[model samples]
Target: MAFGIAGTVAGSADAAEPRLMAALGNTVLTMTDIGPKHTQVSVNDKPVFEDKESDMLSFVGAYSLKDRWIALFQADTGAKDCPTRFRILEVGGPQPLVSYPFGSCSDAAQVTIDNDVLTISMPQPGGGGEAAWTYRNGKIGRTK
Candidate 1:
């Protein structure tokens, strides 16, 4: 497998454009959602992810970066736009995957994919930082 760092991000997050569309080879995954609050994500036509009862706002975002299917699950931490947790998923995946380590909820953050690396950053949160993850050998490893 050829490894290269991807430098592009493709997705839509506008309030008016509350839909997600991504393609992995020929299998296209389309997500429709009501977001930034109680987001319910439906993939390909059926519901696959939802978070309720936590009183924490949840959101779902999808992207096609480096030919990989990436989905982001974000939960707010009571701050206006600050998120407490970000769960990144490589959809339509090769299983037995690596589990990401998320520290205690500290700040608001967003998710990004770069060169096969998935990063969740909470720059807006005062003491909260960020982490980067890479998928290789069927394992998810933190690179930074």
Candidate 2:
């Protein structure tokens, strides 16, 4: 799910018509005056990760870097012997700026923003069937 904010300024007696400013989808979910029309959805069957048997699911999580970039997370599931893994997509240019993979099983993940960076934590198998993940630079770097 996503959130946005929209509002217009009132005209002053000494000035012309006021302009509109909005900060959308940063904190909480807000409705926008903009209407949705002619929206399109597309699907790709080709795999981007290494797994061939696993299926991928992508979704938008949060926005950061002054809304110039959005955090996109993709999870690859259904591997024959490996656990599920996830990847992050950076939305600024045409394609994702970074992609990271981790081990865990989850239907979806959440993103938390601090300053201009995003933090994502995942679960992994430990020595005795436990799970832990220490995410770094959009990927899981350590397991505990």
Best by lDDT: 1
- Candidate 1 Cα deviation (angstroms), residue 111: 4.3
lDDT, candidate 2, 3-106, per-residue tens: 22234345422322112222323322111222221111111211122323345444445465654454444545655555455655444344334455654564
User: lDDT per residue, candidate 1, 68-104, as tens digits?
Assistant: 5665555565554433665555656543121353424
What's each prediction's TM-score?
0.47, 0.43
Global lDDT of model 1: 0.49
Q: Cα-based RMSD of the predictions, in order? A: 12.0, 13.2
Candidate 1 vs. true structure, TM-score: 0.47
